[model samples]
Target: MRIRFKLDGQDVEVDVKHTDTLLKVLKDRIGVGSVHFGCGEGSCGACMVLINGRLRYSCLTLAGYVDGKEVTTVAALARDGELTEIQRAFLENDAAQCGYCTPGMILTAKVLLEKNPSPSDEELFDALAGNLCRCTGYIPIINAIKSVSRR
Candidate 1:
């Protein structure tokens, strides 16, 4: 079936099969190279995206589920090529180890900070529980999130 949705910041219309996942459609059909495929089971957040400002696992989301919805990826956060403060914080903290989980991490972190500008360290840990970063461990990632937060 053909589905229409807003990808990044632009409108997109694409054909997708019933079994096509959002991750597959984004990477294969739309050519969104930033969102990576990790577990493909939603266990890892490599396929995470912000659907209407909520964090969602694209691997588990059907392509049709995103129809007419606004999907935001890391690419949109920068807004015209200038890096967002969150991205810069990640860079400053060296949170991106292998760059596999960085997109998801950054997107989710943006949501977390948006919701709660002064989130506690525990909240940060809880917010990122779904994302697994085997390369850099969780310290740098948490620190990056914390650094960008009001607290």
Candidate 2:
């Protein structure tokens, strides 16, 4: 099947099989580097991306389902080689350890901040519940998100 959608503010069209997961297409066909393949079952939030302004696990999303929809990844968060506010916050807070989950974590934080510019600690925890990071122990991650709210 042929699918057309807006990817990181650019219109994209590609031919894919109905059984193809969006994660596979994004990383393989589209060559998007931010969306990682941690757990293909969607249990891990590693393949997260914003679809139509909401977070979706690309691993579970079928390519056909994204036809005509808008998708945003951590790659879109930065512009002109400059770090985005959230990305900078993550760096300043030392939120990443192994960095395998940083992209997904950042995108999740981005959505949370967009909905609530100033989220409480508990709210922040709840928003990031799906994203798992084995390295930083989450304090730094939370602090990173909080720092962005301060901006």
User: Which residues of candidate 1, in runs, are more than 4 Å off?
Assistant: none
Which candidate should be chosen as best, given lDDT against the real structure? 2
Q: In model 2, state the lDDT of residue 112.
A: 88
Each candidate's lDDT (Cα)?
0.90, 0.90
Off by over 4 Å in 2: none
* Model 1 poorest 10 in a row by lDDT: 136-145
lDDT of 2 by residue, 28-128 (tens): 99899888999899777989999998999999999999999999988887889999999999999989888889888998898888889998888999999
Give the TM-scores of the predictions, in the order they appear: 0.96, 0.93
Clash counts per candidate, in order, are 0, 0
